[model samples]
Target chain A: MASPHANPSPRASRSNRATTVHLRLRKEIVSGHYPQGSALAEPVLAEHFHTSRAPVREALIALEREGLVSFEKTGRTRVRTIEAKDIREIMEARAALESMAAGLANRNWTAADTALIARNIDAQANVQSLAELSRLDIDLHHHVMLRSGNTRLLQLWEPLRWQYEAYLVEIFKRQAKEDYRPETDTIPSHRKLLKALSSGTPAEATQVMMEHVLFNMTWAN
Target chain B: MASPHANPSPRASRSNRATTVHLRLRKEIVSGHYPQGSALAEPVLAEHFHTSRAPVREALIALEREGLVSFEKTGRTRVRTIEAKDIREIMEARAALESMAAGLANRNWTAADTALIARNIDAQANVQSLAELSRLDIDLHHHVMLRSGNTRLLQLWEPLRWQYEAYLVEIFKRQAKEDYRPETDTIPSHRKLLKALSSGTPAEATQVMMEHVLFNMTWAN
Candidate 1:
């Protein structure tokens, strides 16, 4: 008898396939390929993934849950539109989550974890492109959450991943549009945050992390 | 011809029905009527709600998105099981979000807003049941978020509502099991938080809020 799933592999899990498709779609949306408010057609996605509509639909629903997309009453979906207010709210939310993550990381930091984060920060200072810079920014924050020894905190932070990507893209785009030169002063805050994390006090680390996360609130200006 | 929606009301919006059902179901799940890891059958819930399966499924999806439930690959849904690690993560996330909300509230606080929050705090002083206290606790935090004038912050805070309720219930349950008396000193921190909020400085308010939130980490003793 044949399997009932849209795409079935003996060794692969059903969710992994859906996740792969979801990540691809999320990347497209975050990278601005499927610009804000653009319709995401199910059949087209299914064809692109070389699968049935079931997995495509599942991917869309996952993205919808993450605030990267929205569905209409008629079951049609579109990328979520980012507004000025959303940008502010996203920053505020990041400040809270990342600051908390930093405190937890301080409480649970291992020598290896500190070295890993320091390496990311060092690489961050020499990133080649805006996209790489954006990825390193995410990497540093994600590493903090991972080192926090709190899996739930990381899970709570998962939904906002696309928002982080969207925000970074917006920042780089705005700066480029204004023909502004790259700012080198941003790394000092990260360096200070690293110093605070090594301070062995949760309060100190959290305070610096909160301020650093919110520091870019003035970036658009 | 009849409408295809679960509640085919000419006046009631489909989304409104979903919201109503969602809120009720969330309350039930949070209050422990629908225990963690319990299966949520869609058809039965639809019949209970006196509607088609559409709205019940929609409500379930919304709950799932909120992390209150999870859907399996077999098309079955179950309440998420809260683990010890999850509790810690949830508390950390709450501290971050609420502290940020407090800072935002300080920036946007009005005389009327202060009056409203004060009333909630006053009510908190005399709450008769753990359930009521939990509700009031949520209400106070929610009011702060509302006063922040950031709708996105409120939306971001919504998914963690059930976790807050669960944490409160766990605290109360553990205390009861130990036949412990209530602590009278807890109110002082809240009072201090209120004073800090009214201190007219964002840094002062944010610092107090962060400390006040993390104060409970040692409360179980």
Candidate 2:
């Protein structure tokens, strides 16, 4: 995580700019500022970022890979609409990857790692809105995957983060419309997963993590 | 599976050209014509393919994604040198995904699927060279993944194919130098895996597939 202010080589600077643009655009999409099915015009985004079209175009390609956006038949980019089947597929993929992450993390667990997860759970307990909680949930999974120390595993898990966030936003919105809270106690599940990673062997941690992730599929049902 | 002779739409024809160039270039690299660390110059490839640079560049990018070629510091693409560590990592990844694929495949397995896997096993038994056997080995796993009925799982398995082939070439070369024919019977493992997929439940199939894939790691020792 290079500091935003770091003045590196020209090539590094260009990459850093791309990363910054990608994150900002991803945030806009995840925050629901970019509505589903809305066009993300390259020129408009380049102007907004105060950068050339190159980085914006690269960022959009990354977003498409992350399942946040798609190129329409008309050769325009738009925010992807989340479908019920996409949600189910996302949960299934997340469970497989995160369970593997949990096992890998357990092999190299440290006190600091456990503490980070604990802090995430505590932060989740304090969130007043589903959106905040959902963001924290994404962070918790990211933390565990990062802790796994397998670069390829982390790369495989990266694209799923925003897909999960987008799904969360859609689910919360539907819940709000219905005036009903999700029945699952997501906080407890996170805490249980953290505890399993801390106190149990890799196999046990993997089992618990898989169950925690599978809970999302039940929510979809 | 479209025939090369098929007169399709212009766009489809362009895509088919790209695929043809990609496969031809991949074969040249895998057959050791493009030695490890040799530059894959875009213009040279375009000339070789008798096409414009666009499709050749696209093919190079696809090869890069497959872990066969990588961009060097000189801003030129070259063949990637597969390391022993890469072999280990590739095997680890293959095990994880193939194990999941086996489970999904079992959930949707038909007698036709079982027969197809059995045929793969029989084909493996008939291979006269280590290279041929290695290819059939890849095909066997590919068949299982394609049968998994999970598109995401199949996408995850796609890029690993050529990496496995490259690793096989390296391993076979090393073994040839040592005058060592690997004592382990890889064919029996495939046979057992197919038998498990044919008769066992998903969990049982998953365990067998994991064991089969993990056998490669033990070979490294």
lDDT of 1: 0.73
Task: Report the Cα lDDT for residue B73, model 1.
Answer: 72
Tens digits of per-residue lDDT for model 1, B1-221:
25653444444422555667888988888877776789889888887776766567668767876878887876678988776656666666767777788888898877887787778778877767756765776787778778777765677677776766755665565565533222365566777777777765877787787777666644522
| Weakest lDDT window of 10 consecutive positions for candidate 1 chain A | A5-14
- Measured by lDDT, the strongest candidate is 2
lDDT tens per residue, model 1, A154-218: 76677676776876676566666533223465567777888888765997998898888777755
- Tell me the TM-score of each prediction against the true structure: 0.83, 0.83
Measured over the true interface residues after superposition, the C-alpha RMSD of each candidate is: 4.5, 4.2
For each candidate, C-alpha RMSD in Å?
3.9, 5.7
With candidate 2 superimposed using the best TM-score fit, by how many Å does residue B26's alpha carbon deviate from the native? 4.2
What's the CA error at residue A125 for candidate 1, in Å? 4.1
lDDT of 2 by residue, A96-127 (tens): 77787798889899899888888888887677
- Per-residue lDDT, model 2, residue B134, is 70
List-wise, what DockQ does each model earn? 0.36, 0.21
